[model samples]
Target chain A: MHNASTASTTEAATVPETTSSVDSYFADHPTPPFLDNYKDRIQDLLDFHASSPRPIVLITSGGTTVPLETQTVRFIDNFSAGTRGATSAEHFIAQGYVVIFLHRRFSLLPYSRHYSHSTHCFLDFMRPSEDGKNIQVVDEYRPEMLQVLTRYREAQSKRRLLLLDFVTVSEYLHCLRASALLLAPLGPRVMYYLAAAVSDFFIPTKEMAQHKIQSGDGSLSLTMTQVPKFLSILVHSWATSSYIVSFKLETDPKMLLPKAQQALARYGHQVVVANLLHTRKERVVLISPVASTEYTSNPQYSSHTIDLAPGTEEIEEPLVEELVHRHEDWQSTSSS
Target chain B: MHNASTASTTEAATVPETTSSVDSYFADHPTPPFLDNYKDRIQDLLDFHASSPRPIVLITSGGTTVPLETQTVRFIDNFSAGTRGATSAEHFIAQGYVVIFLHRRFSLLPYSRHYSHSTHCFLDFMRPSEDGKNIQVVDEYRPEMLQVLTRYREAQSKRRLLLLDFVTVSEYLHCLRASALLLAPLGPRVMYYLAAAVSDFFIPTKEMAQHKIQSGDGSLSLTMTQVPKFLSILVHSWATSSYIVSFKLETDPKMLLPKAQQALARYGHQVVVANLLHTRKERVVLISPVASTEYTSNPQYSSHTIDLAPGTEEIEEPLVEELVHRHEDWQSTSSS
Candidate 1:
């Protein structure tokens, strides 16, 4: 909506599936999209997605690394499983949608000559498990991942394992802001599953010890600042016209709805998910605050309330089935 | 559950909260429980959190720095609003649970200490408006967070902006592996929101990046190795006794269930959240995979079958709520 140019009207007519990323495949010249200056390619892709009806799914995972002074000062590394993004991507790939699985930090996904993933996983001479179970588990990798690797082995592609890591919050912010641009093309119907533990603030290096954490010293002080909310950026800028969904994982007092409401209000996402801390089981809640307050009375065994709006052609039924029938019987105003 | 001590009793009972950290938090002290060394004056707060019924909420809010080599590293970061942890903590606090809202990267939150966040109406950040009617909405923040920050500020609590940025895959992994111990005592209600963008794979230091971007080679290489699925650790280890929830963000693929199933299988979490990317609206599917193949079929809707088991006595209801209904349902259930 905030484009510098109208772009070619034909872009709406172009649904280039199996297309290239910001950088198209050159076969011989495998360059990152940023280098190829494939802005048009992405711009075209954005227009294409905007003009299309297909739902867009963007997957962002892993940590970001930055270039700093003093031998490249790095901070804030994490122990992420990469499972959130990897498995999610596989799911997206299977769900009949074009997936831009952007992985960060230590991911085990295969690379293509077209995409150079910074290798984030590594081997540690980890201390043997208290009982040795860790060794047993860590000794072997996952099967699905292994299969993906094998597929890559036979696939005719060359990949460089780009192991990009970041310690400073700024570096992660930069990478997130830039790479997040990838999601621009896919307008609306955008659902973001925010499953990452993002930092809220960064401390000053002078207060933090190079090694050793001081307990209750307050001496190790940090000047805290708010990081840019990527979800907000997407809604307010990148995909401002697009529908966005985000997450809120919490615990302690366990206030789910208030947080959900806050999320909906602060980030402009249509839905906000709030889950309790240590909720290893399936008790996560999906709050659709935008739904009419009337949902409180819309009784159905349905665990959630789905708001069906007019105009948009909804398939035979909502994607999620109603656990219980709604009390209201409506005449079908034929829009389809 | 293999144990270093063949004595499962000892291993289970005395499970060190953080013995396996590759990046030791107490490296300076070199003691297992550093709290004990300080003349026992520290009150064993960390231990209390481990045993606290309130369940420990460990939030990692900063980005990680990835290293190019052992000595040189780049600061890779993402743009994120620490809102996820900060606000979520407010919700949890209002829910009447003790929360350990750990943060990094950003520094400030707007609220008074001890404020009951749920007592106020929060602003709707997710909605869009052309006339800026929505923009006029008063921004809402939870009160508990305000209260805590106020206390911390007034107490002059010895604090540091704890931003955990990682620049290399290994560094991220190291930090991640280290912090996992924190969850040991708190056990199962652990909800790891992988909202961070970690690099999927990286270029192996060896024979990769020879033609750096500065040279305009525009070519980078990597021997991408999959990062270990740390999320699975939650499943295999404690969730064997606790619960795990994960999130999946999608783009282009509207069909979101299968990927959720894949996440369930791989991570063994009770719930796998699937959402679309780049939309202003929030849309996600909460999938709870029934571990058992035999499901009770009503033939009306796709049934969500779950194997119910209790992790701890105090968690029975919380566990059930996570297993089936929403968190609000739990409140209703508990109150009713």
Candidate 2:
């Protein structure tokens, strides 16, 4: 299954003219073979997009990590049990999209199996803890997630697919890198939402001694280093890249705009979300920088995207609408 | 603890303005404690009225079933997960109201425990199948829920209090009658959102055997009968002596307004919300008659209160602003 890890894109790929100018951006994107057995996944997504006069979006969730050390890695951890990320995924699906949820272990996302762009089956690992045991867990696998993936599995029955599990930051990075390469052939319309709480820094941990640290905390004092940024990895790793968006949380409100603009400038991302630890439940602000194009046939790039003021209210809708529309326009222009 | 169950009014004893107006209407009410917890209740309620700068609304949630055979019986159960009720409670709390949430068992509310007004902790019950020995159960007796109810419990600490758990509907009704009496002295500002789906029709299964019914070729009879309606009970019960609001869910949109008006007319309630179930959500239209009057040198009833068409986009802020303005008018009248 990993043999076609980085499949070559067709030199003369057909662009369907009947599809809207926005959809043409995702011209290279594979629709992941349609099958009759899966009841929920494809039909809902196709019907919603074909019916509604709005652009659809997919938001990937869970925790992404970076490797900083060889002996032991420095990880950026959050208190999030995946409630906010999971809720956002639900809202996006409700808004109608072929949601490609690259969720982490124990995400507890609703209808995960029948909710992906690619109907791929993956295994998630879990170790028992007291708090973990107490959470309102649905022990049984969700029907929708299981059913769709199994259908896809039979279609590609010839090759055996691999299922890998991770414990440390290095392992997560390796998995993400491998997955990104496989998804590189996807068209530009793919809007990448980096909502995961990725550790910005990591430290080298000894592979043999790493298992020992799980049982007991060693006198592990070490140096830390910044890992390759996800947004950078996202853009540079692919040729026909998706619209990347990253989050920036800071203490100062005034610094939010500059930091967001910096992220956009540094990574060439479409949107940057900034939030304080205090506003975790309530208010959040997102700044979307739409780059204006001159002498372009596509009239959309004629205007620039504006950064809306921050409020606790549902800003996600307006933000997505503006960003996706821009993405659609940008895709058509770049492809043409 | 059951003694706390009584009427929440002192109008019968008080020789206030319009004793005759209500006296002529309700002749046969549930016995004295007719206005349960009336004296101290009324005083504390008056304090809340004087202090609160906004509309004070109390929203009740969950189901209430009528008994058929044994005094503690439930006939039919509707698929109510308490979404509407719990969501409504959060909206009320958001609007800055001094909210008093009368919730039932197993509600999926978010800020219920965090909110100051959430009622006492109710036990959630689950029974295993015939083959299974152990049962699975989860209850929300969070430290926060206990903290909110500590004051109420302390006041009645000197006296004996018994906590009753209800699985069948009749026990729920019995518990509510007493609970409403404790909340009765709250007066006109009280806005009860009766979102619970009390069984309309029930089979005579209250006294059925605990053992599972085996499949048989023999004739099985289900004598279905109209269970006592909670709506009618509220309209007729002494609980409606204070300002009350009821909900009406109908299949037909055309029937909504007429039924809502009928509910307002029958119950003498301030508001009757008529909703059409479009999928899992309700599209509501309110019918509020018998508006409350602010005390003045010449006490005059204000027929105009905040009435607006419900919009799916956003209504939280608008509702708060409208309710607050109306409350200010009430305060102005009271001060003068």
Q: Please give each candidate's TM-score.
A: 0.34, 0.34
Interface RMSD of each: 25.8, 32.3
Q: What digit string (tens of lDDT, one per residue) describes model 2 on residues A207-309?
A: 2233112201312332344444545545544423556666665545566566666565544445676664445445455664433411122212122333434
Worst window of 10 by summed lDDT in candidate 2 chain B: B1-10
Error of 1 at A171 (Å): 18
After superposition, candidate 2 runs with Cα above 4 Å error: A1-336, B1-56, B63-75, B112-167, B203-210, B218-220, B232-237, B279-282, B290-336
The alpha-carbon lDDT assigned to residue B113 of candidate 2 equals 25
Q: How well is each residue in B1-336 modelled by candidate 2, as lDDT tens digits?
A: 001012113121112224342332233122234234433443455464565544455455555433322322112234344566655555555555555444444343423323312221111212222344322222343333333334323322322111122334444454455555555554444445566655444334443432222112222233444444444444345354344556666544566666666544433444565565552252345555433321112212222223334665333334434444544554454345
| Local accuracy by lDDT, each model | 0.36, 0.40
lDDT of 1 by residue, A216-255 (tens): 2312222333333445555555554344445554543335
Ten residues in sequence with the least summed lDDT for candidate 1 chain B: B119-128
State the displacement of the C-alpha of residue A14, model 1, in Å, after optimal TM-score superposition. Answer: 42
Pick out the ten consecutive residues of candidate 1 chain A with the lowest summed lDDT: A323-332
